[model samples]
Target chain A: MPADLTRRKLIWGGLGAAAAAYAGALGYPVYRYLADPAEEAAELAKVTEMELPEEELPAAGSATILQFGARKAILIRHDDDTMVCFSAVCTHLGCTVAYQADQDRIYCACHGGVYDPRTGQNVSGPPPRPLEEFNVERLDGKVVIRRA
Target chain B: MWRGSMAKSSSAGLSALGARVWNWCDERLALSSIWAIAEKKTVPLHRHTFWYFWGGISLLLFIVQAITGVLLLIYYRPGPEAYDSVRSITYDIQFGWFVRSLHSWAANLMVFAVFVHMFSVAFMKAYRRPREFGWWTGLALMGLVLVFGFSGYLLPWDELSYFATAVGLEIPRSLPGVGALIANIVQGGPEVSTVTVQRFFALHVFVLPLVFMGILGVHLALIMKHGSAVPPSEEARPERERRSIPFFPNFATQDLVMWLICFNVLCVMAFVFPWQLGKPADPLASAPEGIHPEWYFMSQFQVLKVLGEWIPGYLGEILGIGLFTLGGVLWGLLPLYDNTSQSGVRARHATWLALIALIGLLALTIWGYAGL
Candidate 1:
């Protein structure tokens, strides 16, 4: 029986080695969950901040284009006089999105992504994430955007 | 003796007959006895990489989704009013928050894990030739997963959910020939009304799960049939290389371990986040600007919008969407034509596809952030 076991072991030794690796591999992600967020934050520390001036935004039913942080967000005055701000990146392929004044949506030229100007909801195209929101608030007569 | 026993059993009548019928199935059919599949079979003992377990984790999450969903079902209704019932499961049902969190986070992670698995498979090129069905099934599962996300989003009945779901219904409207029909059926009208919520709720909890389960069965079967993605030999066989683990005690045991770990992680999440119920979807109030679908759909969502605008409005929307859906199908089926029988690169296709997908994802993420 011992000899037979040895023979069997020889045949399946490679398989066993691989299985051990599989078990080890499973351990790695668990490790990452332990390590990831902190590591990611450190990297994020390198990112710079940007701001937008409010007067640049057009009146009600008007739109303005501005770049903030490492990306772009569009500022618009809706019919209600309240200011709405959205990122200018298309959700589909990450193309630089443009504001479509006529259609009231953000447009991506690369793949035809269209986002609602009012809500930044994807109107059309393949962008997945909604246009990101910028932290902007009214101060006096000006709307200010915080950095990434 | 057999005849005598059979006659005696029959004399005992159908109550005894039912027990007899049940006993006839035997010890091997018992779930506890399934370990027999591994008893004498060879189970490779090599290790696996961390990434490989994402699929297993994803499956675990699905199981959580199933369990929590069923538990929630005790309280959940199917109509617009049904949403409150779902909400009550969290607020009313004992430990409902745990269950709801399990369901929500698990569903989200399942999608994430599917992406990871799919990309990993692509990086490994597991879709080659005989394994093409696996790839196709996986692709279909991906679509269904998005549907899961889409439908589940509406179940929350939040304003973001309402508008996001509305956007979800609209994406399909550009599907060329069947655009309007598909849109109407899914949306239940030209707009997202009570009917739309009802439809999304039904699909989230019922219809899509049935479809997803079927495809998942096919996907797992294919994985077992073809074996895990093989690693390149130049690196002295990846520490995680093992093709033939008995699906029982060996691989199955490992799978159980993985699930336990994932559950632990989910436990932390449920305790931490506990399935946030944002303000009940406000139809009257407009969504705050910069509303986005969850991360998973961002790439295609971004891509489709771009394509629609570039082409003539009417024509572009149709072709853009039609092409996008077809493109996904084509991507899944690509391995059918990629002959690797003699290709020495050996299982590199999956890894390559994973890389390409990552690139596309990265590019889109940048754009998504840019709101390009």
Candidate 2:
């Protein structure tokens, strides 16, 4: 090859190599990012069970707050023989729902949303879905609450 | 032995077939004439030649947005299911996050490139005489791009986008006569709802793209017809002093190299700080604290906020909207307003006015970033 042709080829080759290296440097991380899926299910699957004394459990027509994992849940003793649990977070706007003993339903203060304690169904207002229900069990002398 | 020879013969036959097909098409279409035109094109070479690359860079980013956007459309759903579908695409679908993030980032980068191209053209006075229509088309494209960003913002149906869009739609309400009507048409109802989301999705994916492509086609045709603009300084110089480099290899190679660099930067941004989907929107809930529009709209947001505080009520909104509209109109009609000849040596007063407007916008953007 001519001397000038060799010099031009060397310069172009060097620039192309540099560009390839830069692409690899940037692309490797993006490859990893696209490859890995966010593990939201695994994070939410962590279960926490808490046991409360029988006397501490709310009586019929009343409810008490309980902690499960990172969420707040309402545990209600619907009747002498029945107990139920529902997430305190409202289905409408995610505000904490308050147990209304007088109204006989759970109430969200942000909006006038109401839910049935027995079924966790949105009976009135703007809520579109029922409050998420959690598993509740009575064993021996204590009431156990498990997050769903 | 027969299988190997047959395979070799088939490959050779395919090459012959491809050549014959090319010749048949070339005979009717006269493809060589197109090649001759490309070969004859030349780009001006001067100190301000670097500015020319900005247009090409903007075009490159637009192409990137188109590709990535189509990829995203395969998985994206509009309306009530929009938020969840976006989440699923990002977290569950294979390589969906990368494609979505690339689309989002490229949209932002394209806007940035367009702004730079606009300013460079302004400072260089490339919008003179024959290029006046080209300038108008460019301004129209910029408006269309901003609309694209606004429409795309609501597609995810997240809290930030929800409130930001509410504020965005409210701006048009300050117009005197048909403000509310225009706002209603843009939003598809009295308020932002499923219908609004559907309309915005249509605008972002179908309506805006079609309009943008049409304007872009005209703008590109204008550019090619007129060739690249001569810088004001170069234009003032003697004809013998002017110089140019061939567009085929010299200018095109530089554009390609810049595009490669920009691609690397885009990949790094999409990977390192991928766009986030904020909390799902709840219409019943009040707008969240510190809610703001995208960065590109920050200046207008700050303007409205400050003016509203000072004037108190609809008056402030009208004044701010009026001022912003006036600025936009002035920018669009700049060539007509300032009739400096193409080969003039002295700078026009309009150039100073443009510089001041640019500085004012930059200051407002900074103030918005400071969250004041």
Best candidate, TM-score: 2
The TM-score values for the models, in the order shown, are 0.60, 0.70
Q: Per-residue lDDT tens digits of candidate 2, residues B59-161?
A: 9989988877876777688988999989987877766677778889988998899999999888888887789988999999999999999989999998988
lDDT of 1 by residue, B1-372 (tens): 656776778666656666776667654468335445446454344343555677788788887788778866665676667558667766755566666787788888888889888776675555666778887888888888877877887876767788888787776776667977989987888878778878777778779999999999999887765656553331355455534556556766777788777787877887798887767776678877888888877877777667766864777666656766675665766676454744455335544655676898779767876883
Candidate 1 chain A: worst 10 consecutive residues by lDDT? Answer: A28-37
Classified by CAPRI criteria, candidate 2 counts as: incorrect
The model with the greatest DockQ is 2
What's model 2's overall lDDT? 0.85
Task: Score chain B of each candidate by TM-score.
Answer: 0.79, 0.93
Kindly report the fnat of each predicted structure, to 2 decimals. 0.00, 0.00
Candidate 2 clashing pairs? none
List each candidate's DockQ score.
0.01, 0.06
User: How many residue pairs collide in each prediction?
Assistant: 76, 0
Worst 10 residues of 2 chain A by lDDT: A33-42
RMSD of each predicted structure: 24.6, 13.6
